[model samples]
Target: MRLGYELKEAAKISWVAINSNRLRAALTTLGIVIGVATVSLMGSAIAGLTQTFEDSLSLLGTDVLFVQKFNWATGGGDWREMRNRRDITLRDAKRLERELSMAQAVSVEAQSNGLVSYEERSASSAAIVGANENTAMVRGFLLADGRYFSEADVDGLRPVCILGSSLAENLFPRFSPLGERIKIRGKKYEVIGVLEKLGGFLFGDVDNQVMVPITRFVSDFAYNPDVNISVKAVNTELLDDTRIEVRGIMRKIRRLGPGDKDDFAVNQQDMLMDAFMQTGGTIAAGGLLITGLSLLVGGIGIMNIMFVSVIERTKEIGLRKALGAKRRTILIQFLLEASFICLFGGLLGLGIAYPITLLMQQVFPATLAWPVVLTALLVSIFTGVISGYLPAFRASKLNPVDALRQD
Candidate 1:
């Protein structure tokens, strides 16, 4: 009961001290405000990056694997090695479809960039995708209107095409694009469907592209082209087994000897995700280091101010100690003052960060989640306790006679 009463009395004293030096308290809290804001912003950036990457992964099917000449995660330095790799062809895709029992679907894909025009409206630098019938099943494309090209359309080399949502809106703003003829590289194609908006991925907009039959794309665009094969597993649980099966069958199809290293690469969404996670981790580590420095500077400022506060209150501390006030009471008083200052600063920093977070979301993904808020507040309190400890200890240990004699 006495301890509780003493704690209440200490808190009251701490509040009075802070209220009496409002300007000094505010100035002292500047470091903590900056530190907490920095930490919150960094956390939001990392979280946003992670969310964006994961969303991109969803578009690239988790249960699917890509067979290509070059690995998606490979750096520029490995381009030379990737260049020598044998091109994955339509024939290889067919063979995989025939041989792979574990695969739910297999699709061939090729890409090019061209100008897509409808009347006077045109989207330049538009991605042109050559996809087989199984592409929809493999890539998880959802149609916003009309229908995806059928197997018959692919086999017949039909000039039917699907417009991505963004492209469709740009090309046919007033009316539907279904059955409308559009030119690709001057070759006419009827718009058969519109893909739902899938946002951006890597360097390009996901919804700023068009899909056409691979047969037409190959004949119209190039004489001979390297293609990518997408193989979807029956389920996510069997993805690993499917990948192993695909690698073995691809090696057999390529006529690679048992001792020979596989020339082509089998890529999965996880490969890109893992690479991104490593990069994100590096970025986060660097960001944390910078934030740590800021917090450290703030902590130091708090410590300095706390020491000053302790010295200024020496006579009061001595009077309390001389009148049967416990050392714990003096310690609690200073610590509470520091903690309240930081907690208030942390709340103020969060208020500053909220608008910045909203602005950041315009250019990139950023969210001030609960965990970040909780962490910032906890960090503030922890910084306060640590910074105030030495000063509080000093005040608690002051000799009453010497403290009272101070000018």
Candidate 2:
């Protein structure tokens, strides 16, 4: 028989065999169905989580750097020793600003929690952030209405505030927040601007905060407290050079000698990204462990069903061999049977997983991707081939006389 004719015949025969024992075929496919669904759903969830994190990262801006007293990673560190390190102060920020020319904008930040109130409206838990005038450039926050505080505003200790979008909505839902007065810690401050909505809180949401000048914050809150400095580079391409210069300047400002180990950390977006990657790797590893076991069980089920199939069709195998069928043709036919079973199972699994992925999106950010579908399909086929090999080989090697006499 020609190759195409043989393949067509094999498919028709497999289909008829599956239909003849539909209950058995369906039961055999359960393992594959569960395995594919678990793996594809895990993959889709991780993809969505990564994208959500990236969106949050975008608001921080890759070109900006944060200079602080503590390293984000804090690897192999003694907590007491870290606590003993001097706090990063406003004076350090000033010194760095005076010395570092590569920096486009350098601003110091401090924050406190307080109730934000406007007349009858109030948000009890709100971050009252204290930062310098160039916050817009450094933090990458855009204005929804009005304008950010100016250089003169910081120097003058003006009682002006910028509301984060969510905070604005809470405090002034019916009217515009611009030119409105809100009380923070019993002090009335004029609202100058409201920030555009930022992505969800992976690193604390900016949308639930209020921004004010660092000078006003210190006067009203605490003086000489630890503060974080944000430095924006003049050009993103020269960010590394800018970081190097700023690091040296910060060390000098902190009075750390060349021989002495630095007390403070110079942080960038990539450091946080590394942390995210580590988290992603850990989740993936756990998912793979669970999914692998499920798939292994499924493969064994497929192998067991294939062996049973070969035994049940002993007479059929003998008849095919007696009618001048080659061993290769017999092998191909049985292999195709196993492959089609897995392929169908994979498709059914995808159908089950699609709605699950959609439901997951409603609770968290997640979606099924085409690549994940393709991977499940390929994995199923590969699994079928591996599992069916022994059974197909035994079927092909059976002698016509022995197989015919078995029944």
Q: Judged by lDDT, which candidate is best?
A: 1
Model 1: weakest 10-residue lDDT segment is 197-206
What TM-score should be assigned to candidate 1?
0.94
- Residues 254-355, model 1: lDDT tens digits: 999999987888898888887787887998989978996897798889999999988988998889889987788888998999998999888888888889
lDDT of 2 at 115: 83
Encode model 2's per-residue lDDT on 23-114: one tens digit a residue: 88898899999988998898888778888888888878888988887776637256677789998888888888889899889888997888
Please give the CA lDDT of all the candidate structures: 0.88, 0.87
How close to the true structure is residue 22 of candidate 2, measured as C-alpha lDDT? 93
Give the Cα error of residue 395 in candidate 1, in Å.
1.6
